[model samples]
Target: MENKIINFGAGPAKLPEEVLKEVQKNLIDYEGTGLSVMEMSHRSAGYFKINEDAMNDLRELVGVPSNYKILFMQGGGTGMFSAVCLNLMGRTGTADYLVTGSWSAKAAKEATQYGSVNLILPKVQKYTSVPRQSTWSLDPNASYVYYCDNETVDGVEFDFVPETKDVPLVCDMSSNFLSRPIDVSKFGVIFAGAQKNVGTAGITVVIVREDLLGKPMKITPSILDFTITEKNNSIYNTPPTFIVHVMSLVFKWIKRNGGLQGMYNNSLVKSKLIYDIIDKSNGFYACPVDKNVRSRMNVPFRIGCASGHEDLETEFLKLCESKHLIQLKGHRSVGGIRASLYNAMTIAETQILADLMESFFGNKKR
Candidate 1:
């Protein structure tokens, strides 16, 4: 524990210490296979079983029904933006997007190049809270309704799933994936990149309802097609073997630590410690996100009451680094501080950061 540093980066965030130690212990020889997972053939039984376990454990954790096929694809969430449009847009030629924050906005923009994308709610200058569903224009006949459950940038989160009735719902859960329990049956497709809460950054986990497979646009690449990945058991080509092994390990760790409900409870505690400090800080520490819609995974706040505190913000980040806290800087689009509380960041470590924020300034409102 000497010279320990906590990583609060949004992606490729800190992983569970136990998982890391396991990997370190087996790096040279995985499962007595006589070769590293990195060097093993993707077709080999060892790597294939690792891939299968990760998918099965994740499906159990998130409650994905038997009707959905889980595929481990490359290119993260950005690639899925194009794949979504390619696969589903042709079904109805138009999709509805609820652009709550940066990622959703980017997804909607990418979708425009493929088919008709209707922004149900007008874009806003400030991406603080999710707009009321009543204000949205619901296109009942659209192919699907897309939304980011938790926006990593902008710090806004949807507390409830949007009801599309008969229309399928697509979600990008890249940031908050596995942080809480979800009813997978409600969604047509649910995708998440592994780096945040699962493992490393080479792969993305996509769960697609079996009924929605095989109908991609003609331009869709075979690699990006869900049917192809599903048919091949998510190994159409050589997958990221090492990352998949790590993912499988992380999945077991989550299971051992009491599963999804356990993760959600820990999230509440870690996030509350930070929010409590901000709330008590008066105006010295300011959170740009709405109180109700604030994200548990990513908390973004400014240091000088949201106006003209650029110098103070920099100083604060420097001070945090001194305390062995890194990646607390907020996104450039919204300048401030961001504390990412992924699964691996322990509750005690979160307290250390919270205590630092508490001592940063007086509780009196500026």
Candidate 2:
């Protein structure tokens, strides 16, 4: 098979080739409709069906309950950093956040500007382990307990859902959404940037519990208000038409790939290959995050090689680039190599990467 660039970039990331092929087929004439999905009116029947199908497929993929509203809103996850705070903070006096890494910290920081914010920082002995829940100081009266679910920067993920009651749970699942199955019932709100698993940038999907609507503070912008968006079906404005169209293709791609079960199994295989290589590589490579909280979606590893080769990641990335492997660099906040194995990543591509890692380290040992 042709091993073109293996795009492991996180967000604005790679998409399934099938999805792209489908888009290409329909780009000029979408299902006999007169216009491209982009050119069609957002309120038009054809376009509305595209929107509806996308939401329905998402609902099926995540097992979203009937009571939840799947909203396709503009702005990335950063927008919801304020939107969630605005809509939910009025219900209770304060908002609580779990600071797993940079994203959660920012979510908390933004929320603090609106209401009393409590930030929960995990107790880390090193960059290697996640703090147990017992170690976390959680507040009972907080409006909603917010967490990143998966930290894209630090490569840390909550292996299991946190146990809380009588409070709504909100999660920013940007990087890892649809990477696997999640218990959607546990969250009062789940928002993700489409750039990651959803499809592209410019659109954010917000899944909010029905009851949580209509509680927006008066200061909340009418567009940012959850109640208003829900009422208008997430089309208060023109909406991100082009992005939504691409997202529909992605949603259809997920369904065609055996739905969630296929995605779950594929993720397990891809993640296990990389993690096992890291574990078995005899300390030549290291995964910093604790194994328990390891993010299967984003695998960040450090390479230890001698002779100015210590900065081997730069060279490794270059090598991968030569072989058409793309975007293997880690985030700036946590410097190293991060391989984002989102749902679109195929097992064959990951195996190619695994072989590259092995060969790279084997040569280093020589």
Give the count of colliding residue pairs in each prediction.
0, 2
Stretches of model 2 off by over 4 angstroms after superposition:
122-128, 305-310
Writing each residue's lDDT as its tens digit, candidate 1 over 1-366 gives 335898999988999999999999899998898899999999888887887788888888878889989999998999999998888889889999999999999999999999899999886998999888887878998999999999999899998899899999999999998999999989999999999999999999999999899899999999889899999998899998999999999999999998989999999999999999888876788898898899999999988776528888888899889988999998888878899999999999999899888777743233
Q: Give the top-scoring candidate (lDDT).
A: 1
Each prediction's TM-score against the native? 0.98, 0.95
Clashing pairs in 2: 5-324, 128-290
lDDT of candidate 2 over 182-290, digit per residue (tens): 8889889999999888898899999999999988898999879989988988778898787898998898888888777788799889999999988987777888777
The per-model lDDT (C-alpha) reads 0.91, 0.85
Q: Which stretches of candidate 1 lie over 4 Å from their true place?
A: 363-366
Q: Global CA lDDT of candidate 2, please?
A: 0.85
